[model samples]
Target chain A: MTKIYELMPDIQGEEMLILQNLCRDYSEEKLRNFATIYRTRRKDPLLILVLTLVGLAGFAGIHRILLNQIGMGILYFFTGGLCLIGTIVDAVNYQQLTLQFNRRLAMEVHQLLNREV
Target chain B: MWCLLNTFFACVLRTFSKKTFLSLPCKDFKSDDGMKSGIVRFFVHNFEAWFWLTSLILLAFMPPESTQTTFCVWHLLGFESCLGCGLGHSISSAFHGHWITSFKFHPLGLVAIAILTIRIVSVFNQNYTFERLNKKFTHDKNL
Candidate 1:
């Protein structure tokens, strides 16, 4: 009886809780499928943090683009991450941003798996 | 400077990792203080949405023509100009109905506002639908 977190060690506690809640009724096979698809879709918080730090070096907004926020990515790209204030803020809140994106991803995966069955 | 940046990043990562491990999972919902925890969880889950909303409101209220001190870090660090320097002022002017002045302050201010508005809406929409799904699941489980 392996736990959901065990399957995805990169996921934070809050995200694990969300995933567990979503997959409460899933069979083992379905859960594995969900995890496999989700692993490919989810963004790594550490990667986002590094990208945001790159924003400080005059290449800002790559992280936003990675997160599928193209408009914000462009703004950050042109404005130097709102003069680096936005980049600094994004650095501090990288976990939250990643969590939000991952939560959406988990929901999408859940729906997709359920539709398949 | 590189050493300083590395140290800062390391500190941030350490703090975040510590917080992540300490955070409780779904078991918190079954506790005696369900209502309090639910409210706290809502705030924790939707923090980014609230942040953008608060910032937009504050910007909307700020006087467009005030002689405010600059808060740009690049300026403080002795840089002559940064691409984002006049963005806030531009947004403030736009909010106050001065489209020409907003463009004069910064051409991209209006575009930024539109983009931020869209981002805020989409974030809130995602949370709304997800919460509804959670509630439906819980209801079905109880039955």
Candidate 2:
């Protein structure tokens, strides 16, 4: 009897592969949608502001935890939050965060865009 | 002291002054005007239209220095950093032994800069295709 995995081709599309051995389960269709929206729109550059606020508002350093800006996060956590000044600076320059994120995301989608037929 | 102050202010002023976009109003200018126009786009969305309007307003009012400072010009993006912090400082540090300073500024700073420099050289020093192709060659190994 043929399994469902047998019916559907693997990512390489021409081979027999197990579903369990694979990584994330995002389908091409979903990745395509993620790619399309990411490519065609402008994401709000306000995330920097948001992360900045989180960094300031918490002792655990919400900003670092979420954004993975690890070094600063650790610094803030240890120094009794001396980095608030830096966070304020980031809030003021929120546009840069937006632009940088957009550029990186665009690069990510560029890969997907190249992938989709 | 004065030279350092002058340099810092110069960078700040440059930051404010950089012309990030080129624009000509749809009413006043013809789109087909040639080469000096580096890149051009006719904004379709309402948001983009608003952005251009805002840009023009900024063009009219703000000095360049204040604007550049508002960028992610330095690492305090409210969180730690990303891979790109200390990028500006790393090259400057390499000439000096600002190793700890640069690493504190950004871990991937020098590496990112080196890779970027190499890539840029390759792009110009050779031929590269910025392409639109299929996903087979673009598979996600992590997925």
Candidate 3:
């Protein structure tokens, strides 16, 4: 039986705990399915951070669009990330943003696996 | 002041570095007792929403023609023009019922307000759903 850590080694700490809690009662096959799907869907915080840094140069808001925030992306695009203050803040809070997105994705995956069962 | 800035930058660098990016500090979730920390956690969790809201309010209150000082880093860096240069004044003018002036200052001022307003609402909605899902799982564990 592969543990959650073995299945998703990149996820750690609170994210790991949350995933474990989510998959508490799942069988090995279902857990594997969930992990596979969730891994592909999850956004990497480091990638987001890099995109945000790029935003400082001229192309602000690509990160927001990548995170499924179209309105914000547009706003950032037009306003230069609210004069780059918003971009700076986003750069600082990249971890929280990624965690929020990944947690939502984890729940969606859990529901998906449940439906398949 | 330098020490504080250095520590802040160091912390930011550490957060972005490959090695420590995955294991985020559990400060937001670890403390459940202190009232102050809980408020801090709430702000941290919904930072984007709060930021837009605060910016809008500040813009609303700012005088339309005041040119005493600017907080724009681009201007500080000696750039003569920036994409967001007049946005703040435009929004402020719009808030003060001068739509024509707002348009003159920045064509997208009104649109920016609308977009930011929508973003704030959507962010709060997302936060609500995330909290509800978290509660649902924690409840199941107690059962």
Candidate 4:
């Protein structure tokens, strides 16, 4: 299997390091499978940023829901993105939000792969 | 009960001061070890429920209709409309059993209340599947 970082060179910084650490114990086949699954499921921070910008028009919390924060998404939708203040904050921090969501995804995927392995 | 209340406030103080939820420095407290962990766990696990319940309580106290004294940043900034204009009024009306008016004000009020109730009640059980699903989509600061 490809080295974790080389296989997913696009993911860098903390998330990359995190995935690498989680996969350290994985067998080669398990790592390849994880890379494949994670690549498909990973959210694009850019997409979340675009969606947050969409809040200026309407549909305030779609990105939160995409990140699986259903309650927060609903709160944002009902509160008009917490009167748009929260939306602006979210827009500014979309990368962090994406990273947070992706980290959780990585953890879950890792656990599932472990089970399978 | 008193201890629980104190722990709740401790959690709140940490949240405001640190600008994070579930990132409490429980170990720094001088409280007894077992109780500290219990309180921290309680705060960490029930953070969302407390958040929604607090919001619900606050909204309940707000005047259903915006008064002259009410301040709206949207109106202040000269925006014609905003996504959450009538939501507060909607929530208040819904709480008072004014379903039609609540929906007319904001269609999401009842749905929000229902969701919050579900969330508040779900804290008692550890639904591992749902937890896993939720974890996949949400970030835990303490994690």
Candidate 5:
């Protein structure tokens, strides 16, 4: 079976280490299941950046909407990205957004998979 | 002399009404308290949907000036140029199918609509996820 590192080659920073340690107890099959679920749930930062660029082209808050930040998404839509300032800010901070979302997804998947069987 | 006397009477009547109005106690309406809480909660919960929905509906129905006049602090302040100056007009134009005009006013109008559409869709996604999670927990508890 593939190691966690092989499954999530792109995982980095604290998440990489945390996920590695958290999944250490799982069997090969359980780890595969976790990997499948996490992969589906996780969002790529690069994808967020791409969506933010789409915001620049026309839609200003698609990235925020994708991140499940409906409040901020609505704000950005109504305010024209707060006169494009907020959109620029989000463009710069998309990586952080991606990290936060992925982290939450990781935890949720972890909890779901670890439920007593 | 008759006109002068009539003017004097009118002045006295105005003054008397003013005095009585000023002397009246200011009453706070009790029902307003309940209404305020409900209004606040409405905004606090799922405010995004309400905001976008309101904007879309208003933009579709009301003329641009009506919505623009109230919310635009920058315009009210007499600023020659502000970041959001043309955005409302742009959105209004887009709603009217004036794509080129809308872009001319503010290029982000279409983007705003797209983002709003996505947000609306995600609300459904959010509810579905919540239900799925709830069911998962209930199933786990049953077992």
Candidate 6:
């Protein structure tokens, strides 16, 4: 499945083989079986920025939202007003959190690329 | 309600960022379906994305001028001052020829300004190998 950006002919030809190698034999049944499509998940830079903005505003939960970790994002949102504990915790572990979300998103995208359309 | 908003924003992220790992996508994704390999690359790229975002957050808190005294965003955020306090003042001192003041504020501030300035210039000159440099640092850190 061609990602939207690579649909153009010239660009398509240039990186075709490389892209083909990247997206391989995962069957449609396997993809649907996985529950959430692993490859479709993406970390929006804007969301990351907003999350970081919230982080700067001493709201670590914002990072959770960017990761689609809704439960935690809210916990932090209300709790954020109370202290810096969450923010500090986030700052320390942000790398892990961001990585986790990206992994989830990557799986989803892989599924999308598998779609028949 | 706020929780719903958070979910909405997360959806926005899902819609906009197509490939997730620094914008890479499987265009020619035919039968081979390298899910495992793609994940490895995703993790590798995530490190970078995290670093860049963290750096951005760090810079975002750099107190602004003119209203530096009156408008303190960090304070608004409910945190104490950062380690590199008075950095802006130190930078100003460096330009104003106040060496003592610059060092007094933050000894490393001027050096940071210098290195970053040099790198920015190198980027403009197209001599900057950002990926290679990051790899070197990543290696050094591991070592």
Please write out the lDDT profile of model 3 over residues B1-143, one tens digit for every residue: 22123335534544444332332223234443455554545555666677678678867887888865566778889988776758888988999999999999999899988988887897789877776777787677668
- Give model 4's docking category: acceptable
Chain B TM-score for the candidates in order: 0.71, 0.32, 0.72, 0.58, 0.58, 0.38
Per-candidate TM equals: 0.83, 0.34, 0.84, 0.59, 0.46, 0.30
What lDDT tens digits, residue by residue, belong to model 3 across residues A19-61?
Answer: 8778877789888898899999999999999999998987899
Could you give candidate 1's per-residue lDDT for residues A1-117 as a string of tens digits?
Answer: 666777888776668778877887777788788889999998999999999999888999999999989999999998899877678768877887888788888888888888887
What range of 10 consecutive residues in model 1 chain A has the weakest lDDT sum?
A: A1-10
Fnat, one value per model: 0.53, 0.00, 0.43, 0.33, 0.14, 0.00
Order candidates by DockQ, high to low: 1, 3, 4, 5, 2, 6
As for candidate 2, its interface RMSD to one decimal place is: 15.4
| 10 residues in a row with least lDDT, candidate 3 chain B | B19-28
- Clashing residue pairs, backbone N/CA/C < 3 A, model 3: none
Candidate 5 - CAPRI tier? incorrect
Best by DockQ: 1
| TM-score between candidate 1 and the true structure | 0.83
| Candidate that beats the other on TM-score, 2 or 5, i.e. the better one | 5
- Evaluated against the true structure, the overall lDDT of model 1 is 0.76
Worst 10 residues of 2 chain A by lDDT: A11-20
CAPRI verdict (incorrect, acceptable, medium, high) for model 2: incorrect
What local lDDT score does residue B95 receive in model 2, on the 0 to 100 scale? 31
Per-residue lDDT, model 6, residue B63, is 35
List candidate 5 stretches off by more than 4 Å. B1-143
Cα-based lDDT at residue A110, candidate 4: 76
lDDT of 1 by residue, B9-93 (tens): 4445446444233233343455456556555555555555655566667678878776455666787799876677677778888
- Model 5 chain A, poorest ten-residue lDDT window? A83-92
